[model samples]
Target: MSQNSLRVVWVYPDLLSTYGDQGNVLVLERRARQRRLDVQRVDIRSDQPIPTSGDIYLIGGGEDRPQRLAAERLRRDGGLNRAVANGAIVFSVCAGYQILGHEFINDLGQREQGLGLLDVISTRGEGERCVGDVLADIDDRLGLPPLTGFENHQGITHVGPNARPFARTRIGKGNGTGDGTEGAYNDTVFGTYMHGPVMARNPHISDLLIKLALDVNALPPVDDRWYEALRNERIAAATQPS
Candidate 1:
């Protein structure tokens, strides 16, 4: 990795890519290249040692057992924590989102340790699993459009004071705490429950990561007509009156 090229690490794909989460990294690479920025996309498996030099790291949804295993390896690996300490950006979803936090309930119905990068915690919510299309308003300060994605999880995440709510749930259970919140974020890291590869449905979030990682105020614009169309359709479907 060099200063001129952005290195994006896809962490533990062998374990955490239960959803089509690979699209998040793909979208980021595409958007960066659209600006003529060089990108090195690295796919790191669980057995390999994680590199802390990557500019961005992406983790994705997984089953409970995989989630537990990934979390444990990440903690022992220590690379993610060191990377975050050095100001690397992280974006994770669902199970990966939970792994970024202090703790989450795992498959054995036992509390599992997390990366402790985010202040949030995940606990099993009584009743049915939260599943379906979701519509959320990204934090007003971010100035991004409504975030649209799908959700399918049984854990309810509680955002702690150290982090800000990534979005307000407009049409789904979201964090499942009934507080109208969706995810959690600090300055360099963000966690979300939404899947649909997220970045494909909301390109702004991906751009946000690029801007933050590069310390640039703006990115060169790329055509987003198709993205807008898909976003509008998804948002409409998620928010439609039942």
Candidate 2:
């Protein structure tokens, strides 16, 4: 988290880069650089070891097989947990989100252990997948605007006492836990189901990540007019999708 540069690690792109979740990293890098902050972006594939040197780490959505493989590889590699222990920030989506928890149902329908970075537990839900637009109110504590994006996961994640919900679902089945919660966050780990590459649809969230990573109260402003316009358009559609 140096003023000279911030390292952003993209984890398991070969496996977990689904649902345009890679945009989260792109937006993070863009915002930082636009503010004249240097960024060292590293794409760490599934086969390689994750590095603890990063200030922020990003994981994306993927199918069951890739998710299972990524979880296994990460748990074995041990760098992610070490990074978290060192206070590095993490943002994950869908399958990436699920595998950050204590455990998740794998492609074989067997229980696969997660990194335990998040205290939640994940299980594949029954019936239909939770797909299409999502509209949610972010946790009041974050004091952010409404969340608008897309959800297409069968994951039913239960937030344990150690963690809290990231948002409340106004539309679409988030977490599919029947609790109307959309995501989970604890300490430095954050996970969500919404995909419009999420941060691209909600630039404030990107700013939050940057601030947290830099351990700063605020970030230098970057142009967000385009991001705001997209967020407004999506929120309207999610509220009145026809």
Best lDDT among the predictions, by candidate number: 1
- Candidate 2 worst ten-residue window by lDDT: 215-224
Q: Please give the CA lDDT of all the candidate structures.
A: 0.93, 0.91
Residue pairs with colliding backbones in model 1 are none
lDDT of 1 by residue, 1-242 (tens): 34357999999999999889999989999998888888999999999999999899999999999999999999999999999999999999999999999999999999999999999999999999999999999999898999999999988999999999999988998999999999999999999999998999999999999988988888878999999999999888877775
Instruction: Please give the distance, in angstroms, between residue 39's alpha carbon in candidate 2 and its true position after superposition.
Output: 0.2
**lDDT for 105 (candidate 2):** 98
TM-scores of all candidate predictions against the true structure? 0.98, 0.98
Query: Model 2 reaches what TM-score against the true structure?
Result: 0.98
Candidate 1 to truth, TM: 0.98
Question: How large is the C-alpha RMSD of every model relative to the true structure?
Answer: 1.2, 0.9
Worst 10 residues of 1 by lDDT: 1-10
